[model samples]
Target: MQHRFEDKIIDTVIYTALLVLSLVSLYPFWNALVISLNSGADTSLGGVTVWPRAFTLDNYQVVLSDPRFFRALFMTVLRTVCGTAASIFFTALLAYGLSRKGTMGRKYYMLAAIFTMYFQGGLIPTYLWLRELGLFNNFWVLFVPWIISVWNMIVFRTFFQGLPEGLEESAKIDGCSFRIVLPLSGPVIATLSLFQAVLFWNEWFASGIYINDESLLPVQNYLMNMINSNSAQEMISQLSGVSGGVGDMVTRTITPKSLQMTALMVVSFPIMLVYPFVQKFFVKGVMVGSLKE
Candidate 1:
């Protein structure tokens, strides 16, 4: 009876803690949605919580209507897809080469690569190098610097090493190239690709620094610039000034913050949608790739 009562108390405490943590984790996203749906003018009045006081779609309308938004969205999507694919291919290729026991100087090459994980040429030198290479202001700059991630390479190598030795020998005997192993690495590839995609999708700092052309900037960079500058406010103010037809409702409902929140949701929603599809692969990959026999 005593042990049962103690276990119940412990379980209650853990459940309570988990509930609080979940709420804390989820509230910000919920609040952003609420603020986005609420009338901007009403949102500005403050104290709006749990639900939108004046529900409106004007925030999304403002975001979707902008030409720049579409351009940024296109750039973001392109970068994520292309970057993720290129990164995984290169990283896995390097991992495959290094995983072979017969490869000469593999240890030295791995040591050098791992060295880069802990040290780097600082920002100024990297910028100068990119500039000299003519990658500055170029779209390739987004993914080129990150094409072969050392950490991801390590994971791939481990996963590759864990494959049955006879499998590779049999494939080779059948006149197959080492590249044949890639078809068997689907889980790790899917997992790492998803990770790389999310990283590219959320990345804004590199784009802000390396990409001077606004058209090349991704959605995150666009959102960052809008939030940091007065552009969102200025655009909303300009829209508000047009006092006829839908303009009056726009003026009454939409504000810079609301638009910002809506854009935030827009930037996050696609990546959020991707997780469900690859989740099983992600879990399996992480478990298998992270462990070695």
Candidate 2:
């Protein structure tokens, strides 16, 4: 009876601690949502609590109504889908091929891949190469240069290596080819696809660096530009509305905090929406791949 009571106490303590931690992790996301729905005036005064003081969709309306928002959103989706598909396809093929111990020059290919990971031609030369390829200002600019990641390749290779060699041998006995062996490896494929999808979705730096055209801007770059422009405009408007000659002070003060909160919400929403569906597959894949067989 005493031991049972002690276990109950321990369970309670653990649950309480986990609840607290979960709240702490979730607080920032909650705060951002509350702030975004809050009136600009309320936000400026830091009047927003857990719930918005003056609930309005004005900010979202303003953001969504902009043509650039739609353009960038579309471009981002395109990049994520196409880039992820191409990345997974090539990575999977290479990983499967490399997993075969008898493949010619496998050691050299692995060494070369690892070497490229540690060393690369600098930015200027890469840019020149892209330009030579006529990918500058092209939509392919987003997907072409990053069609395969070495790290992802290594993960996939390790996963494939973990699979039973007898499975392939059995399939060969049944008149099945490597292509047939692959479709049977669903969990690993799903896992790598999810990883690559997240990579493509989260990528903004590449778009910022490689894409100069406004039409090709990914969601992150678009949101960043929107935040900057909106903050500036809001500052100007607020300053003009205020009677005080302290225009510069007011402009400097209010914009950054509000914009920071808004940008956080904007950038995080897509990932939050996506995570639930992909998360289960992600966990399963990693577990299956991590096993040594």
Candidate 3:
């Protein structure tokens, strides 16, 4: 009876703690949504909570109306899809090959891969290297530099090692090769895909460094440019009907900040929509992959 009572108290405390944590974590997203939905000018007045003080769709219209927004979105989606797919395919292939014992100098290659996780060439050197390779201002630049993630490689390799070797051996005995063997690594593949997708989706720094063409900018890079410089103001200036009025020192109420929030939502919404679908697969994959270790 005492133990039962203690468990109930513990459960209550945990639930309360979790609820508080959830709200704390969710607040930033809620605030962004509120700001995005509010009148651009009204948001300047501040004090927005979960609900918009003055609801308006102008911010969305302003951001969506811009052609560059669509282009950036397209580039972001393309980079994520292509990068994730390629990384999963190639990384899994590498992991599988490395998982097998006696793969000839595998230790040296693995050591080299691990070495990179601890060190990277500074920006200028990397930039010069990209320049020499003619990857500057190139779409291919996004893929090549990030083609392999050493940390992810290690995780995948560990998971692959945990998997049974008999599956591959049986298939090989029947004249099948790794192509057949690779697809069977379902949990690890799903797990790696989620990680790689998120990594590729959030890419901005490399784009800024390698891409000089404005049209090729990924969505996050575009957003970062808007956030840090006059680009957001310039973009906002391009927005029509941002007119706000007053007889006594009237000024435009909508600021670039609101537009920034709107722009933020434009890129984030797709990811939010996508996460639900992949979440179960991702969780299952992670659990199974981690089971052995």
Candidate 4:
């Protein structure tokens, strides 16, 4: 009876603690959503809580009306898809080659690759190299330099090494090539590709530094610029019918903080939507190379 009582108390305490932590962690995002939904003028007056007191969709309308926003979104999506696919394919190919037993110079190649993880050419030299290649200010500049990742290579190699040799040998005996073996690594690929996708999606620094064309800027960099240099009036002008129309009334209600929160939601929503689908793969992929048969 005493043990049961103690367990119940512990469980209660743990549940309460978790509930408090969850609320604490989620409140800021919730507040941001509420503020984005509320009228910007009203949001500025403060004291708005759980729900919007003056709900309006003008902030999102203002954002969506901008052609640059669509271009940036498209650029970000393109970068994530192309970068993740290229990086994973090339990295996996290298990993597979290195994982093969008796590959010549494997040890030396691995050592050199690992060396890069600890050291990088300084920014000036890297910038000069990119310039010499005429890649600067190009759209591909956002992801070309990241086409290979040493850490991802290491993970891929480890997972590939743990794969049962008998599976490949059986496939080979039936006249199948090594390409058939790649399908067996679905978990690792899916997991790593998701990580790579997120990295590409959230990348802003490369776009900011290497891309000069506004059309080439990814959503993240555009969002950064909007937050840092944009004004409410400038954003208002981007909306149609702002000349003494409903948009004008909407424009009057917009504040920078409200616009910022709306932009944050727009930027974040896609990734949030994607995460759930790949979550199961993530769980399974993380356990790769953890055990051996």
The number of the candidate with the highest lDDT is: 1
Order of candidate numbers by TM-score, starting with the best: 1, 4, 3, 2
TM-score comparison, 1 vs 4, better candidate: 1
Candidate 1 residues 7-61, lDDT tens each?
A: 9999999999999999999999999999998898898999988998988888888
Give residue 138's lDDT in candidate 4 (0 to 100).
Answer: 90
State in Å the error of residue 261, model 4.
0.9
TM per model?
A: 0.95, 0.81, 0.90, 0.91
lDDT of each: 0.89, 0.74, 0.79, 0.86
**Which residues of candidate 3, in runs, are more than 4 Å off?**
240-253, 291-293
Candidate 4 local Cα displacement, residue 227, angstroms: 0.7
- Across 59-79, the per-residue lDDT of candidate 4 in tens digits comes to 887778778889999999999
Error of 2 at 120 (Å): 2.8
Considering summed lDDT, which 10 consecutive residues are worst modelled in model 3?
244-253
Model 1 spans > 4 angstroms off = 1-8, 177-179, 241-244
lDDT of 2 by residue, 110-199 (tens): 999999999998898998998899988889998879898898788788877876778878777888757675776677677777677777
Error of 3 at 114 (Å): 1.5
Error of 2 at 149 (Å): 1.7
Tens digit of per-residue lDDT, candidate 3, span 1-293? 99999999999999999999999999998899889888877777768878998887767766787788889999888988898888887787787677779699899889888888888898899989989999888888888678787777776788778767777677778888676666656766777777787788887988887888999999998899889999877865544334543211113445688878888888888877877777767767776556564
Q: Which segments of candidate 2 are over 4 A away from where they belong?
A: 1-21, 229-267
How many collisions between residues are there in candidate 3? Answer: 3
Model 1: how far residue 174 lies from native, Å: 1.4
